[model samples]
Target: MQCVNYLFLVLILTPILSTFSAKILGLFLYPSRQHALLGTALFAELSAKGHEVTMISTFEQPMVQKKFRHVLVDGTQIRQKYSPSLMSLNVSMWEHIVFSNSEMKYMIAELLEDSSLREFLDAGEKYDVVVSELFAEALLGISHRVNATTVSFNPTGGSYELDYLSGNSHPYSYVPNAFTAYSDEMTFWQRFANTYVNLFCAFSKHFFNLPMQRSLLKYYFPDAPPLEDLMNSVELHLVNSYYLFETPRPYLPNVVQIGGFHLQKPELLTVELLKQLDELKNGIILFTVGSHRKLSDFPVQIVETLFASFSKSSHNVLVQYEGPPPSNLPANVRLMPWLPQRAVLSHPNTKLFITPGGRSSVVEAIYFAVPMVGLHAPGDDDSQLSMMANRGFGVCFRLDEELREEQLSGAIRNVVADPVYKRAIMLESELFKRQEMSPLDKAVYWVEHVAKHKGAKRVKSQPAAAMPLYKYVLLDVVVASAALLVMFAFISLWLCKQTYRVLIRRRQTEPVKHKIV
Candidate 1:
């Protein structure tokens, strides 16, 4: 009987295992360049692991033509009648964080409402698993409709609610007043903030999904966790930050961390670029605001201040300027419209890196062991690194007017001279290394797991919350009833006590009255 039971179990599990080992399709949906790169990288890596993968993106980059199937989701093509300018995209992005909040929800709704985007998805492609950023939450209904498992991939150190989905404790709670920005670590306050943001996020989702405003919230989530974890609509979550970069916390079994997912084949520099870098023997000081922002776009005063600071520096300066060098370019400075960053960072003569804290740039610096004089590129670029600076990972420069040339010079000197910063970074590098699994392998493993077992079905696609704030919190009944009970109990207790006091006083009053008479 036992043998028969075991045989039946094996029979059931075999078909599931077989399904997970076959071909799969992945949905990589961010329209932004940085996020597009991440999605493309995952698609390539997953395809290499022996699955048929199709990619969808917003732009025309080299990755689209690669070995895997590609779907070019030209939002411009979608908005054929209404091409949103790049600047408009930025403005909308800004409003998203402050106003819309759950960018994923807003984007998903936008995509859904657009007939072009839906037509793109309806092209009759079957997917086994869906890997997307948390911001991609607005489209869970589609994923559900198609029967796919979803995975949330994060490259940045995430807030606590995100950490909860990743199966570990946030690191901040482990150490107090230590690292800044994001620790993948949660402080007590950080956890509180996560809760607050989640509550706000659910409402934000409501706003984004106003088309479904009335009945959606009521029917959606019957067993949802707090609002903070609202859009964690994935079967599994993979965070790009490692235990080394972030603090560990308790997460569900499905959450995972595969740091250094952005890593890839090294860039080979042009001979001209290499020669230029080598000639800067007094050592090189490089400045870049990252690909998203052009250096010449810096405020005139800030550009003047940087030029003034370079005049006093002992090292030769290399700044990636879009236009000609600033008129004030000192004799020691060399302006190149474009510099291969990997080559510059790897150069023997390069001593200090001066730039915004792009994750790629940060990793490149770490890889090359080059110290940085970071002037955080304003907005989301700096938003992630503001905490990295606080954690003592790098020297953060305020781009404010008060930051003069002398301060820049001093900060450069401090970053270059300080050995501890290097030590801390080296230690971080080692931790990053230890957490390093070939992300390609992990991604493949999961893809295959889904295909073999038809494992994707286990994941549900709707919001976890079954009811709205008014119903879930039970505020209407709980608050009113509790308030009334408290008032009634207080009044009854006060009346009884007063009556007892009066009787006792009356019993003792006869002696006092006789004396007084």
Candidate 2:
């Protein structure tokens, strides 16, 4: 009877003990608001599942759970230091790279000195898992210090750099760089350029960024393991990418594509906005440059061109402009400081979306089945928007194009007038909707699984991380084959020459040529 009672007691306590929450630390230092939102989705979900989450970021969270703590970092100086020029659209790739490195260094130094962060570090807080944005690899030090499994998160899609770290395959021939305006099927020159750019970026990261990352990690956590080892030691990489928008490519088992994880059911539009939208007899067009860019920063001429196009179009143009409203706005145009983009897109009257082709914006547009006219900027925007155009769901024009006004207006007219764009988008939307689980659900599960299992050792591709470059690319085999072929050719030539010499010597020595003559 005593043994039966003990067993009953053990069974009753097991579930209660297992229900205890795990502690998670999230360090999301990306300065962009949209990127912050992505990080927010992650932490908020973890907290909802009864995990204790401590997040340090530039953005604040309204999450009121007692288990959720937000350590808002002051990114004002960092933001100002790398602030993109509003008046210019001609920033070079090298300049962007330099600025990005500078930003990472500054953030790392600041975070190290931050009193709150230092307090946690000094106190030796224990966490089951540490989450950080994949950029600024030095931030992985947080996980190292806490002795927690690291999980890298990327609000943007995958890239060769990230692929290399995660041991994912990204052949430049078929897998275009996220920054280039090329499709998977490339011309010879395009492939060459892609390969060159990938190599350049790889070298730049290795020579320029890796040293700084190592220095920072050493400065903060002198006893920690090597930074490069810690970077790959990252158990999982959660990327914001989908095979629908991106070319279908094999990813490392540890790399999870949780694209559209930020998506939620569209909120009901305000009555006033609904009524206003209903008044658009020809339908509405939503224009947003995404969260990071200020629509007001557009050059006067560019704004004039957009306005000019809007003036001629029958569609009601609703612009999400951060700055003061433009003067002499056309009656058909309306400007708001902010618009509920997802809600606006879900509206039946939202006939089009004009954006700078940021991944988040493009995903929302496709999710809502709205045709788009892309005013793409440099960087990944160009490639993503270009891919959309290639896939027949939208049209893309570079923001710096001399004839942008004409192109923008033409694209708008064409997309709206034709049924093909709509049909294509509807098909993609249906396909996107066919997923068995939401992206957030998948992300949450993987994150929790990594923590529960102590790491994702089983899912990680072993050969990818362990294989050296020469072996992985088969360079050794190619070089050996080439050397063999050269040796054989040389031997054959030498043998032929020797045979000729022998024939000549025999004829001269024996005097046999007289008979032949």
Off by over 4 Å in 2: 1-15, 85-88, 102-104, 265-282, 466-468, 477-517
Encode model 2's per-residue lDDT on 400-459: one tens digit a residue. 647466677888889998999999999888888778889889898988988888899998
lDDT of 1 by residue, 41-65 (tens): 6777766655667666666546433
What's the TM-score of every candidate structure?
A: 0.69, 0.88
The numbered model that scores best in lDDT is 2
Clashing pairs in 2: none
- Model 1 spans > 4 angstroms off: 1-29, 63-66, 75-96, 99-119, 141-147, 160-233, 247-249, 323-325, 331-349, 377-387, 390-393, 455-517
Instruction: For model 1, give the 10-residue run with minimal summed lDDT.
Output: 80-89
Q: What is the lDDT of residue 89 in candidate 1?
A: 18
Candidates in order have lDDT scores of 0.59, 0.81
